[model samples]
Target: MTVVELEVTKSADELAKTYIVKGILSEKKEDDALHVAIATCAEMDALVTWNFKHLANLRKAELFYSASLEKGYLKKLEIVTPMEVSNYES
Candidate 1:
């Protein structure tokens, strides 16, 4: 895996806010939304996380993807755990 130097960009911030506005994420979970937003804006193919409660589940994935699409992030981002990628099958 290559190092990806990512930051909290303006577009990411706005997208994160959209997640909050849509009630997909709470403000207290701002960090979670920001993480997703950043990866979405960075055009990442996937974002590996162990936080299954918020970031690495199917229900949350649908919500996050919908919110991202609303913000013009057309590409789908896979939010998965390390194990998922390690054992991925296509």
Candidate 2:
């Protein structure tokens, strides 16, 4: 098993702050932003979340995607639910 640790660096902090200040996410949901930051910082292609109210919604995803681009994160971050990307057989 491979372990990936997410660190809170200066850039990640700034990204998280941007997410909060831009109203993309509430301050109480900072961890959600941090999670996104981690994914963005790692240059991940997608970020799966169960938080529909914030991360998994179309509007919020658009805002976060735009913000990431504006912040120089070139790759588009696909915010989606586990079910959306899952390969579970019924």
Candidate 3:
């Protein structure tokens, strides 16, 4: 990747870590948080995960969405499991 690409990636990484440090993600689930953070930062409409204990739970989803909105992530995010999506598609 070009220097600019590398820099952008670094910035996104920092932002993901910031979410954890700021308590947006409980218990420092860095990898799981990173996945959600990426989707949030990218302005995706949904994050489909099997991580019901964290990323896919109602409480955690609410927290993530609220914190993201407060931090200027305008697009509201939906957290769902892959099964949820597949069922919807079916």
Candidate 4:
């Protein structure tokens, strides 16, 4: 159980605003909230969580990946679940 720190940055408020506008809540909202902030700062490798309802679903992951790509945020952003990473033997 490795816990990764999600420090709030200068852009955190703006990130939360964006998610709120999009009507996302709870885990989904939190995941995007953190990712948006990280995207703004370009300071994270992977966002590991177990919240498949939001962050870990393949469909949602792809959408997030594509959105980040379009915004030039993909270089530093990756969203995956703990189980997804753990499943990889290598």
Best by TM-score: 1
Expressed as tens digits, the lDDT of each residue in 1-90 for candidate 4 is: 434556676565555555445444354467566665564455566677677786666766565555445544545456677755653433
**lDDT scores of the candidates, listed in order:** 0.92, 0.85, 0.71, 0.57
In candidate 1, the residue pairs with backbone N, CA or C atoms under 3 Å apart (3 or more residues apart, or in different chains) clash, namely: none
Better model by TM-score: candidate 2 vs candidate 3: 2
* lDDT (Cα, tens digit) per residue for candidate 2, span 21-84: 9998899999999999888878877787788987899998889889989899988788889888
Model 2 scores worst on lDDT over the 10 consecutive residues at 1-10
C-alpha positional error of residue 90 in candidate 4 after TM-score superposition, expressed in Å: 14
Which regions in candidate 1 have their CA more than 4 angstroms from the true location? 87-90
Model 1 quality (TM-score):
0.92
Candidate 2 regions with alpha-carbon error over 4 angstroms: 1-3, 87-90
Order of the predicted models by TM-score, top scorer first: 1, 2, 3, 4
Best-to-worst order by lDDT is 1, 2, 3, 4
Steric clash pairs (candidate 3): none
lDDT of 3 by residue, 1-90 (tens): 111111235545665676687786754688777777777777666877788887888888888777677667778779998777753422
TM-score of 2: 0.85
Q: Model 2 misses residue 15 by how many Å? A: 0.5
